[model samples]
Structures are given as C-alpha cells and as structure tokens.
Target: MAFAENIKKIFTLPDLRNRILITIGILILIRVFAHIPLPGVDLENLKEFFAKNQIFGLLNMFSGGAMQNFSIIMMGVGPYITASIVMTLLPHVIPQLDALSKEGEAGQRKINQYTRFLTVPLAAFQALAMIKLLSAGGISGQQIITGDFTGGNLIIALITITAGTMLLMWLGEIISENGIGNGVSLIITLGIVAGIPSQVRNTLAVITGEGGVDTGQLLSFVFFA
Candidate 1:
C-alpha cells in the first residue's frame, strides 16, 4: 500500500532512482574497504580477543567488525565524526569560528575543509592508541598486534589507517553531493546493520547450546530494543 506506492514513486523519479543506486554502490565500496586488512596483525588472535573484551566488542560493532579483522577501514568514520563534533562545538567557544559559520555556504565550505584537515591527526592518534592497546596484553592477553611499535611497521600502519579514514571521508562527501541520504550517517547506519545477522546467529546459538533458553536475556534484548 502506502509504503509500496512510495517506493514505486521513488523509482519512477529517474534522479531519485539513480541517487539511490549510487548510494548503494558507495556503501558496497565501504564494505569492501572494511575487508582490506592492514599488515602485522594476528587475525586469529584478534578474533579471539574481540570475542572476550566487551569494550573491543563494542568498538568492533561500531567499525562493522573491521577492527576484529584489522582492516584498513578499522577506524571507520570515527575520526571524521570526531572532527565534525569539534567543528560543531568550536563555533560556541571561538568567536572567529562563529563569525565564519555566519558567512553562509562559503563559510560552511571552509569549516568542512577544516574538519577534513583535523580528521587526519585524529585518525593517526587513534590508530596509534589502538595499536598500543591491542599490544599491551589487554586484548585477549595475546599479542594480537605483533609488529614493532617503535619501528617503521607502526608508522606504516598508522599512515595506512589514517589514509583509510580520509578515503572514507572523501567517499562520504561524494555520496552527500551526488547520492541520497546524509552520507556519513548512512555509512554509520550501514555498519551497525551489517553486524545484525551475526548477532542474531549468536543469540540463536546461546539458546540452542548448553546454555539453553534464557528467557530473561531474551526479554532484556526486547526491552533494550
């Protein structure tokens, strides 16, 4: 009915249809990037580590499991998001930034450029911190991060991950300019949705395995949802 008609109407508009297709294509590209792993990672240990740590598990969820895979896109849009937040708050704290924001489209474009520039250092810092955390006997108490932190390997990894974040940010900007939806938000939403099937399977396993049915757990999930 109404939903079907709305969908049909959307497809009937050529521009809208094309935009939707382009968005889907961009999302697929992001997922592909999420599978492209960085070097010097112990994949098996990383997986085991993610399974045991709640904080890492949540981080993996945000990155669409890219962190578990040690993917190049492991940071996802995190640095970009952080940059955006900083920009949003800067206007309140800095009078110059507030004035720049009042300059309309030209002002907004400058602000966006600043955000992009800021994302790089943020991404680098996050990458280094993640490496240190994974290697400091925190993640699964195993050496998931096996590279020499003091050597070129760490530098290379940091550069690769930061570049990955920048690439994702570029893709998101392109999607926002040419495709449907708020591109960055859509990308984040896709990452969250992508992990649902595996979560469902895990829930099923908990019910069918030695634990049997946990009605309280099931109810809590529903309530939380």
Candidate 2:
C-alpha cells in the first residue's frame, strides 16, 4: 500500500483510532491547564516583560506560553524532566541505584517514585527562584508577583506551583499508559508548536513595518540556524 493508504488503514483500525483520539484529547487538556493562571499574578506585566526579554520568550515557548500567562503549570514539565534526568544519571554513578535498576519493573517503579519525590523540592526551588527573578528590578520591574513575598503568601505561591508540576507529571504518566507516543515529549512538542502563529505574525510585522529591519536580529537568527 501507498504511505497515505497505510495511514488510512491504520486509522480504520478502531483500536488505533481510539488511541489517537485519546492522545489528542489529553493534549487538549494540557493546553487548557496552560491557560489557568495562579492567583495574584499581574498577567499584563508578565506579558510585557516576556515580550521584552528574549530568555523569557524562549521559556514561554517551551512552557506552552504558560509562563506568559503565569499559569498554574507555568513551570511546565521542567521539574519532572530534571528529576528524570538526575535519576537516569544516578544509576551510572551510584552502585546501589545501578543494582536496583537491574531488578526489572518493580525496581523501575521504585526509581520513578524516588524521582517523583525529588521533583517536589526541585519544583519548589524553581518556583521560588522564578518568583524572585520576576520581582527583582531588572527582570520585570513592574512587580509582577504583587503583594509581599516574605510571608504565608510566599509559601502559598510555592505550594501552588509545585502542585501544578506534580499534576502535569501525573497527567503525562496517564498519557503514557492510555495514549500514544512519549507523553512528556509530546507535551513539550505541543508547547513549542503552539507559538507558530504568533511567531509568523511577529515576523510579518517586522517585515512590513516602516522601521528599518533589525540587522542584528537577522544575523542572530542566521547564526542560530
């Protein structure tokens, strides 16, 4: 069969079609979560800062633009990804971890559980760091965090962001179990792809505007490519 016909035949199989649909539905859920903001954020200030900061612009892309909105899952799968990486490397560095890793499914489950525990602290640390960075005069200047940062409110913010990371980790695991492809990879891919329209719009704006073209930015793009 031709490639297109093979694809059609694959989808015609009810099982494969259902799995694909479920995967798509789960991805949609992730996008929805990316828009649900955490409390007390000055979204307009955040957006303005993100527009001006290239580093933040890249962060927003990787985070499904969740960071731009200060969404609950603004940290994206970063903590989980970091934890997984650490665990993967630990097996090579620690003899005990190496031994456990060789014990099959139960051992892998234990490693995963440990990784999950590690993610909590990592998420909390990342959230606090992000909050401080955004509140500092140089990054956002406009006090995107709002209110005081030294009391119960600070704790609340940490907990909220950590919880969001855990929630995303759980959702990704579900996708791995019930859907198609590597769930975490698919999530990140969607986040990056989500910025396409805005990128095209900005490129067009730069091309058509009365202002002279930004040669530096053009050169940077060329070098990056």
Candidate 3:
C-alpha cells in the first residue's frame, strides 16, 4: 500500500502529469503519421523491395514503416542525419566550416540553419530516388503523378514529400518549445519503441503456434534425457 501511495504521489505532481500527457499525445501523432502512405504501391510489393535493400530496410525500421509506405514523414530524420554526417565528416576537410563550428551557441545556430537548408535537397533527392527504386523493384507503375510521371506529377510528388518532412521537422521544433524533451529524438525513439509491442506480439503468436517452449522441452528430454 505504501509503495502504491509513493507511486501515486509521483504522478500527482501537476507538472509531471502534464508532461507525461503531452508526451503521450505527441507520440500518438507520430505513430499515426508513420502508418499513412504516400500512394502508388501496395504493402506486399513494398515489403519485398525493402527485403532487398538493407540500407532502406534499416531506414524503414527506424521510421516504423514510414519509408516503405512513402509516408508523409517518409524522409524521417534521414535528411537531418545526412546533414549531421556532412558536418561531422567535413570538419576535417573544410577549414572555414570547421572554424565557424567552434563559435559556441552562435556557431551552433549557424550550423543548424545550414543543416535546415541542406535538408531540403537531401529530402527531395532521396524521395525521388526512393520512388524510382520502388517502381523498378515492381512496387508500382503509378505515374509519379496521377496519370504519369509527367512534369506536373513529378513536381507534385517532390513537393508533397518534401513538405511532409519539413512539417515533421517543424512539429518537432514546436514540441521542443511548448512540450518536453528534444522533439526530433523523442519522435524517432517513440517510433521504434511504439513498434516493440507489436513485434513481440507477432513473434509470440508464431511461438505459440509451434507450441513454443513446451514442445522444445519435450523433444529435448526425449533426445538427451
């Protein structure tokens, strides 16, 4: 009873409750976006395409299926990651960028602005490449546009996906300002953590179908004992 009361006391703190609830709400929104698709491919075809590309599979795993579906948030933090990678690797090769990097808060803000700019091209190119790759892998023949990969549809898709990622980036920033935790990190972490239970359930169902540990133990006893 005392242990229960202590736990209750912790949750009863108003600030903590609000933070916890805010996190939950943000987490729910991220999950909802991850499942939404960008149109053009079926789930089975997308799965096969992912199976062949380890790099993309890893990306999908991190994004919680957003990449496979070409979801609004499909680019996920990939653009941000690419930007960080550039900053990390360039410090040794680029003297000017490196010098600016050491300017404390001012320097960091500059880098962030650069990253946001860099993210645009990175997101667009990656999205276009992914669309082509998915189609080549037999995932879709849908016009990048509705009727064809015409100039219009291509541009539209480019805009749609790019805006999607930018929106996610903006939302993450908002969360950081008005809610709690680093928005981007929390969003990605939530994506992965949110999938864990479903993964476990799927694995468990397979195990149960095969009679799981009980069957394994019986066979072991028959052969060794």
**Candidates in order: C-alpha RMSD to true structure:** 3.2, 3.1, 7.3
Q: Model 1: which ten-residue window has the lowest total lDDT? A: 216-225
lDDT of 1 by residue, 1-225 (tens): 999999999999999899999999999998998888886678888876765454565567678878888999899999999999999999999999999999999999999999999999999999989888888877446667676766787888899999999998888887898998688998888887775554444445556778676564344335334
What would the per-residue lDDT of candidate 3 be over residues 131-161, giving only the tens digit for each residue? 6665554344433222244377778888888
lDDT of each: 0.81, 0.79, 0.68
Error of 3 at 183 (Å): 2.4
TM-score of each: 0.86, 0.84, 0.72
Pairing residues by index, what is the TM-score of model 2? 0.84
Poorest 10 consecutive residues by lDDT, candidate 2: 216-225
Task: List pairs with backbone clashes in candidate 2.
Answer: none
Q: Any residue pairs clashing in model 1, and if so which?
A: none
Ranking under TM-score, best-scoring first?
1, 2, 3
The local lDDT score (0 to 100) that residue 107 gets in candidate 3 is 89
Residue 114, candidate 2: Cα error in Å is 1.0
How would the candidate models be sorted by lDDT, starting from the highest?
Answer: 1, 2, 3
Candidate 2 lDDT, 1-225, residue by residue in tens: 599999999899998888788889988998898899877778877775665555666677678789878888899899999999999999998999999999999999999999999999999999899888877754545566664666898898889889999988887887788878688888888887875444434334545677545454333334333
